[model samples]
Target chain A: MEVNEYNACVREWADALFRFACKCTGQASDAHDVVQNSFEVLWQKRKEVETGKAKAYLFQVAYRKSIDHYRKKVKITFAAPPEETYTPANPDLKKILDRALAQLDDQARALVLLKDYEGYRYEEIAQITDLTETQVKVYLHRARKILKEYLVSVENII
Target chain B: MISWENYEEYMMMHADGELKPAEAQELMAFLDANPTLKSEMALYDLTRLTPDESLTYHDKNSLLKPEPVKRVISFPKWRKYAIAAGIALLVFVSLFKYIDTNKNNARIAKTDTTKPIIPEPANNTSNKNEPQPQQEPKSIAATTVQPAKVTHATHHDIHPQITHNKQLANTKQNDNALVNNITPAAKATTEISSLPITTTKPLPSEIAMASPPMATIPAYEITPPAKPTKRSLIDRLPIDEANKRQLKTIAHITSGASRSVSKVKEEIDGNAITFNIKNNNIHISF
Candidate 1:
């Protein structure tokens, strides 16, 4: 890829990648580290990557690095629910959804974030998660079922 | 055709908004017929995670800035020179080894060296025909060239001179010349004139006949004059440059640093000076 094209990739996708990493890792610092490392890896391998495919390549590297980062953080902190849900002028439904998202596994939450947050296709999510399309569909269906049940429970409580 | 019974995949695709335009029309028509499923499918969108602008980093300019490309591996500067030095040392060592082995091979091939040949006893009865002058080197060469002497390596040195001396001996000036000429075998010998000749009783003629008579005599007199009657007083001696400087320094010291001729001469007349010059010792008695 040309230098300008690669630099454009960095400008265009840096925020999207940071959002994905931030949503996956749930920490500003860890997400920052993941995005930085992913972009650094992309820069190192920029010559081999095409300009059009740089986003996918960056996501692939970020997905792997974020997964590793999540695993390291997982070991130190058992999967506890978030201490407090930071709600900012969001409706109760959005708050409930945020709480439900915090309840999902790192992989499931990342898959959901990639799907709804980034609108990645099932195949792209499958590539990022190292899963078959069928498995991605199955797991995403399960994650949606869980979130639906949580939403239903919050509605009944209200 | 697009009902949930036959193609639930199409329904799920429709829920994800993955349907193409024609499939979207069919899915909308089917969803219009089944009004309950439309609201049910809307739940997928309601549960979908929104792109929270708060979550998306805005100051990602720091990240968006281009880092220097790191594809090239930079080796330490010393590594290039070290590799070059290693190759040069390898070549130099190989060259040295090659030359060393060849030198050993050459040494083995050419083992010949020049060794002085000595003559044998002069005072033999059957050697009455032996010329007294040629006795030293001739007897030595004859003995060495005899069947007992395995060292014929110097035979080249003996051959040319032997041929020349044999022709001279063949000239036969007188009986003295005849006696010398009779020992034609002596002409083939090296000149061993520096060695003092020793006389012993002659062996039988049988042994004398077995030896060659050639000898190359050096031009110096075969015998030295008798030893000096007594030591004589020496007047002066010539020395090399270093000793000459030392003499000047001694003369200057004794001449009250003037180094004047008469004063140094007076200093020299008072002392007996002994010195060695050109391997000869001289003693001056004042």
Candidate 2:
């Protein structure tokens, strides 16, 4: 891909990648950093990426960066928040949804987000997440079951 | 064909639109049988995380414009070496020019002795504080110190320092001749350093005269302390000053008949050594 094609990728995919990263990382700053790092990786390997697979390539990098960032944040939370260690009940639908998403482990949450938000196929998600197609299906199914159970608590859901 | 355990797989496939039409119809029949589980479809909504209307991409379109490329310039290693070498050459040239200028200045200062500094053509050519070494042959004092007394001593056992006076006399024969001409006394009383003519500094007018008498009085006082050894008897001889020069002879003589004689015989330029110890006489000549 050329510079213009990369710029087009940035313009078209930055928002989607940023949204996926934000949901995965639970922070705007971390999501922004993830998007920036993903795009930088894309720019470095632009020569190797096919023009048709730019979105997958971008999400692939962003997905990996988000997983790493999520692990680091989880480690930091464990180190810093001894007093606020208990999970407070979040009533708002959006906060509850975020909490439900946060409850999923890294690969399961990434699997569900790649499937639902980005509409990536099982094979494409497996390629992006570096997993087998069957593994993606099983993990996504588990993540959805968790989300359904969390939402079932509310009588009138948003 | 789907069992209760496979119901989740079917529902997930239905939610993902991956279920066949027949499987979808079966999944809807199962959901109709369990109406309370219908709200579980909320997983579909919960899974989709669309960006909020308030959220933006932090102006990603601005990134399409190229960032400015920074250029860094640096000098190479060879350039630094060249600069250092040029400075060294410049310093070397400046030092050379400075030394050459000093040499030229000293030469100009020396040759400026144009007039006859000593109006009477005196023995001391040390006027103007510059030694005039060239006015030796024609000076009145130049006729005194003989060439034989000033020949260089080359004996193997001789000390370089004791024989150094003969070397100085040979090199400055013109000045030394002036020293010898100061008195015909040729006396052992006056040492070479006590010469009145070579006194470069001021002295008392009476003692400064060409008077060996006062000098001989001190020599007489110092005589008792002198041992009467064979070296001293030779030292008392007037010809002792020539010992530093080429030895003319060593005569060892006795009135008795000859017992034995040991001589170092080497012939060079008519120099010879004759040891006649039987008569207690030894002659070594150069």
Candidate 3:
């Protein structure tokens, strides 16, 4: 894609990338860093990227950066507050839901985001997650089942 | 009325949104009969639709922002090495020249005289001359009448006074022969002896007298002074009276040798006036 076109796409897609990074790290600052780093990588290798495939390329970089951020977090053993902590809770449902989401493994959570939040097809999720399509379907199914069970438990407790 | 085999296909198709209206109707018919499975499907749909509070997603467009990369520049290996080597070579050459020039100058300044400039008067003129037949009359006239004038400057390794006495004899000889005859021996003695014993300054005539003394001293000292015609010859002379004895002795022996060789069959000629005379030794030329 032309640089201007690529830039427009980045502007359009930055929120979504931030959201994904926010999901992965559960911290806005870490999400911002991951998204920023991914874009930098994309800009560096933009010439090699196909115009139609730039979106996929960008997601791939962001996903990698997000994973790296978590890995580093784990290595350093830093404890970050859940994303919903910033929301002043009228009912505290958001905080409860966020705590439940954070409890999921990194891969399972990424699969859930790719499937439900981004509306990626099973095949595209598999490509992004480097899993088989069947695996992607199975994982998404399981992730949803787990979320349903956890949310029900949380609601009952509330 | 829905069999378990049909139930799996029904739920799978519903989840995928791929059910035909009739197939969906059949699934609903099955679900309405099996209420437990219906609740499960409803629950799954709700779970899928509900927003994840903790999660935020970024699309590719959002993730790609431009940043600048800095490049590192470096100098080439061979060029740097060549420059270093050139500087080292220049320093080495300059230092070598400095040491060699200083050593050479010092060696030249302290040099002693071993080389000789042999007086080759025979080379200048080829002639046979005899001594005057009235040798006694000449001696009586030269030595007795001018005892203070005829001086023979003879220097021995032991004493300088001997050379001074010989110089007195040369003055006496010249006193009888010609009042104006400037005998080098008498001139040097008279000029040197006239100066205060401790004074270092030499009269102009003494300087002239000292020139011949340098010739007798040695050949090595002659090379440096050879370039400056006036100062070189005189400069080679001993600066101190103490060293003059050695110089005069060397001169006396050299002049004596020349006189003996040239004295055979000498007759009185205007140009043949003898400058060298020792006991029973005379040189004559025409």
Candidate 4:
């Protein structure tokens, strides 16, 4: 891609890449680092990437960097009380969804973010996440099922 | 086509927005037929996450690149030619100056080598009463012959001779005034006849008889200065007039002789003299 086209990619997709990275890494600072690194990699490989494919290339690099970041961090125990014991007092849908998203693993969360937030097709998501189309579909489905189960819980719905 | 066994797959595809419109309609129809399963579709729909439009990479300006700069310099045709001509002129002048200097140095060396050595005249204070040899007259006659040894005397040799003649003239006037009162003409004639004629040229008898001699007539007044000493055509000129003639002679040997003389004169004058020889103009200032 030309320098102007790469800059256009920065203007157009930086936020979406950041959002995806934020959802994957669960930390705003790590997500910002991932976004910065992704764009840096895109600029380095601009000669090889087409202008149209810059967004996908950015997401791919962001996905790998986010995965690396996820691997390096000490695993946090996301232990929740039993579904019956939880209170359903929180009505903020965005907060509830964020809590629900935090329940999923890094790869599955990135798949969900790439699908729902960016609205990439299964094939495109597979290209970004480096998975087969069938695997992307299966993972996304499983992630969606988890989110549905969380939302459907009586404590979460109220 | 949408049965209970395959209903979940259609619902998942519907939530992911990957299902065809006809398949989605069929799944909705199957969901409506089973109201309990319609609640499951609501939960699937809720799984979709709306992006937070506010979240953005704030420092995106850092990623942008600027256009590369190009610099070029060009000169006009006339300016190029003018520069070339200036360089050519400077080189020509420098070469001419160098050749002129070398020629002047060589000419100065030649002139130095050929310079005549002026010998001191013989001692004048010998006994006058004692009979001297007939071949040699006294002091003045001996001094006259010394000029013959310097065959190539230049015009510079004349200054000392002129000064010597003036001194001799003064001495002769003083001696003649004193002696003319006391000595008679017949006594002076006897003394003149007694003096030896050393010169190769015979004295004219009529002139000797016609002349009224004093007790001491300077020998130069008697002999006519040894026929003025034979000299080269260049050396015959007076010193002031010979500069141009000498320059011309050196010019025949080296082309830049006149210019070299001018340069030498300028150095001697310490730039106090300005002599310019230009086309159709000669400028001189002091």
- Candidates, DockQ: 0.27, 0.25, 0.22, 0.52
Per-candidate Cα RMSD to the true structure, in Å, reads: 25.2, 23.8, 29.7, 27.7
- Each model's lDDT comes to 0.63, 0.62, 0.58, 0.70
Off by over 4 Å in 2: A74-95, A156-158, B33-53, B65-286
Residue-level lDDT of model 3, residues A53-128, one tens digit each, is 7777767777878777777664422234444322225545545545656667777778777665677777887788
Candidate closest to the true structure, highest DockQ: 4
Best by lDDT: 4
Arrange candidates by DockQ, highest first: which order?
4, 1, 2, 3
Give the C-alpha miss distance for residue A135 in model 2, angstroms.
Answer: 0.6
The iRMS of model 2 comes to 2.8
Model 1: runs farther than 4 Å from truth?
A: A75-92, B1-12, B22-31, B58-286
Ten contiguous residues minimizing lDDT sum, candidate 4 chain A: A77-86
Report the error of model 4 at residue B260, Å. Answer: 99
| Candidate 1 positional error at B75, Å | 41
Best TM-score among the predictions, by candidate number = 4
Candidate 4: segments with Cα more than 4 A from true spot: A77-91, A154-157, B69-286
Interface C-alpha root-mean-square deviation, candidates in order: 2.6, 2.8, 4.6, 1.1
Tens digits of per-residue lDDT, candidate 3, B78-155, equal 988998999999999999999999999878765523322222221112111312121222211222222232232112
Q: How well is candidate 1 docked (DockQ)?
A: 0.27
Error of 3 at B181 (Å): 99
| Residue B77 C-alpha lDDT in model 3 | 100
lDDT of 2 at B41: 51
Q: Is candidate 3 or candidate 4 better by lDDT?
A: 4
How big is the positional error of residue B191 in model 4, measured in Å on the Cα after superposition? 99
What does the lDDT come to for candidate 1? 0.63
